[model samples]
Target: MARIMSGVQPTGNLHIGNYLGALVNWVRLQDQYEAYFSIVDLHALTGRPEPAALRHAVREVAIGVLASGVDPERATVFVQSHVPQHTELAWVLTCLTPLGDLNRMTQFKDKSQHQPDNINTGLFTYPVLQTADIVLYRADRVPVGEDQEQHLELARETVRRFNHVYGETFPEPQVVKSSAPRVMGLDGESKMSKSRNNEIGLFETADETMLKLRGAKTDPARLRKTDKGTPEVCNIYSYHGFFTGEVQRAAIATGCRSAQLGCVDCKKLLAQNLEVVKGPIRERAAVLREQPRRLEEILAAGAHRARAEAEKTMVLVRERVGLGAPRS
Candidate 1:
């Protein structure tokens, strides 16, 4: 099986946007690849989360991953910080990465602008670490959203540079984009992000999910039941595309575009359908929460397996780069 790597930040509850966007697709690939799913706690440090919050975030993310059907046995699921090789390799890649290359990363620019008060070296060197995360595992296929395509390109560039100087030790990683919904936020404005405060969490209880969906925006053109609204233009209808079946989606689309359904009626339908999907996830998360030791055991074992593989890779890397064994 081909090796694949992907990471999720342990910042907050991964919302529906995460589910429909990435986790859903990851579940399908678990059996098809030697997958490594990581709770990227180190990556979350750039934003400077509090210690307690960070720890909680890590557990929550792990729970979410397990609940989402990423089998620990099938795919290596561990916290990124557990594998020190990631940071170690990142330093090597950092040296080869040019300032201009990091400067051009659009995500770096966007995130830096958001945190002008605390823009640190970690933020600037973010992509270098990201490059190491993929190449450290020698992953050939990386599942990415449209937003991360640029960074993936940079990782490929770093591989080319390293091969040019140090000889070919790592393969250039490939992008494996998910076919799920592109972007789904709570407020229906921008990407569903915890920082954006515009996300409906995947693990939210049925009541909580419905509450958030209740006041969610709809076609402004839909002021009343009688008025017609275009489902093609409505954000709520877009959501239906994820949870609703093909037959139901076609029906909703036709009804919405024809103004046969009011915005509230449309949203009510979406909320109901969404609950049906999220109900089981919520139940699974509850079960995981009740067993904290289980989550820890999963992580400990995953870290052990990941460390063994990383150590083997680093041995060859040291030899290829003419570095001797560790000093006593």
Candidate 2:
């Protein structure tokens, strides 16, 4: 089976945007690929989360991934920091990455602008670490959202550069595009992000999810309950495209355009459907939370498996780059 490498940041409050956009899709790919799903705590460090919060975030993300349908038995689900090779290889790749290349990364620019006061080297060289994460496992494919397509392109570029210099040790990774790629946030303006504070967490209670949905922004044109709103322009309807079946989505679209459904009632319907889909996952996550040792055991075993693969690649990498003991 082809190997796939993918990860989500330990952002603590994971939302439906994560589920409909990536996690659910990851669940479907496990049987088809040798999936390595990671809770990338290291990646989350750019934001400078407190130690206690970071630990909690890591556990929360792991539980969320497990509860959302990523089978630990099928996929090697591990914590990124647990595998030391990721940072080691990132340093090697960082030396090869050009300032110009990193400068052009849109995410780097956006993040810097967002946190100018604390913009550090880690934020600048983030893509290099991401490249290391994928190439360390020699992943054949990487499941990514549209925002990360540029980073994936950069990863492929790094692969080509490494191969040119070291005689083709790593294969260029491919992108496995998500079916529902860019999930808009409750604000209906930007992508659902923890930093943006526009997310409705996947593991939040049904009541909490409903509370968030009730306040979610919809088509501005629909000022009154009787105003005809275009579903194509409505973020709520886009959500329906993900959570609601085709027939229901059609009804929603028709209702919105014809002014048959009030935004309040429409939002209620979405909340009901969203809860139906995500409520069980939240329950499962609750159970997983109670068993902290079980999560630890899972991470430990996953790290062992991941390290075995990583060490093999690193051994070859060391020989190629003359880092480790010289081969006989």
- TM-scores of the candidates are 0.96, 0.97
TM-score of 1: 0.96
Worst 10 residues of 1 by lDDT: 180-189
- 66-179, model 1: which lDDT tens digit per residue? 998889989999899999989988987898898999988888888988899889899989888898889888998999988888889999999999999988899999888878
lDDT at 207, model 1 = 76
| TM-score, cand. 2 vs. native | 0.97
Candidate 1, overall lDDT? 0.85
Q: lDDT tens digits, residues 1-328, model 2? A: 9999998998768888788777988899998999998889999899899999999999998999999988889999999999999998999899888899998999998999988888988999999999999999999999988999999999999999989998989999999998878999899999888889999888777788778888888998989998999999889888888888889888888898899999988888888888888889989999999999999999999999999999899988888887975344
Residue 216, candidate 1: alpha-carbon lDDT: 79
RMSD of 2: 1.7
